[model samples]
Target: MEPIYKISTKKIRLLLAAVVIPCLIISITRLYYCDKVEYVRPLALEGEMQLRNDRFGDGHYAARRAGGKRHAGVDILADLDTPVIAIRGGRARALIDEDGFGNYIIITHWDETKSLYGHLSRVLLPPLGFVRQGDVIGEVGKTGNANYKSMKAHMHFEIRRKGKTIDPTFIMEAENIKK
Candidate 1:
């Protein structure tokens, strides 16, 4: 007698198709979710927060005045000489040692959001270049027009979307804020 054929060709085909189809579907779903959800962390680690003020002490706060005056940026005050990291995976769109921002590093993120780290003591090499998420962008210092008296040596962080300034607090979801 001929050796009996154990499994049918149709069953084998079905088994292979079932396993392959689910994997393909899962991969597509994962990609979609990953693209949609962009996570960013605070530029600075846990530290002391200082009072917010305009560089010139003009009574108007940096964030509030920026909105109406078309300035668009937020200022977070952390310790001086603190390390500033990239919030998300993105390219260094621009690095400017301007009058007000000091040694500033601007990162253009995946979601078209730009995160600004200012008042840096020293910026890393390849100044205007690409960097991975969590890369050290610069060291926090009272550069630019930072009011060291009131703000101290702190990282002035800002987030801009569509070339307009929005509240950085809205985007930051880090639960590391100290009391």
Candidate 2:
């Protein structure tokens, strides 16, 4: 009996290449975007902290400012004075009140990565002070651009690598740390 169809070696190789190449490319892309790093929740409290705004492409990050500047971080809706902590061990690079970030603290991690905690009601650590992971750093509030009568209090958080903004959700999720 003759087979109705016979697959040639070249055809088999081409079939495998079509499937394998795309899979490899997809895996590499996923790894680049979803790579995990050592990080913890900035807030120690349990339960789901509603996202007021997410990183770029959603929420304030997508909205342009007066000069067409987009929001640079995620905003986690929380009550006024909610405790904020360091996502990793780092030094408090700057702690100040500004027109945009309000009261914010920039923590420079050992890897040169930085985390910004903004819209804070209070800054606990002094500039250049070291902070341990999970240590209390500040309390959330509607400071800076968040100070609107209709705007609920929240924490605007940002993760930066070499001064470039990266999604904080990716870092938090990679560590399985809930926001």
* lDDT of candidate 1 over 98-132, digit per residue (tens): 57788888877656678887778888735447676
- Candidate 2 yields a Cα-based lDDT of 0.72
TM-score between model 2 and native: 0.69
What range of 10 consecutive residues in model 2 has the weakest lDDT sum? 28-37
* Residue 143 CA displacement from its true place in model 2, Å: 1.3
| lDDT (Cα, tens digit) per residue for candidate 2, span 126-176 | 444867677789999888878888787888889889889976766545646
Model 1 regions more than 4 Å off? 1-37, 47-71, 125-128, 147-151, 174-179
Q: Model 1: which ten-residue window has the lowest total lDDT? A: 28-37
TM-score of 1: 0.61
For the record, the alpha-carbon RMSD of candidate 2 to the native fold, in angstroms, is 12.4
Instruction: Quote the positional error of residue 98 for candidate 1 in Å.
Output: 3.5
- List the global CA lDDT of all models: 0.61, 0.72
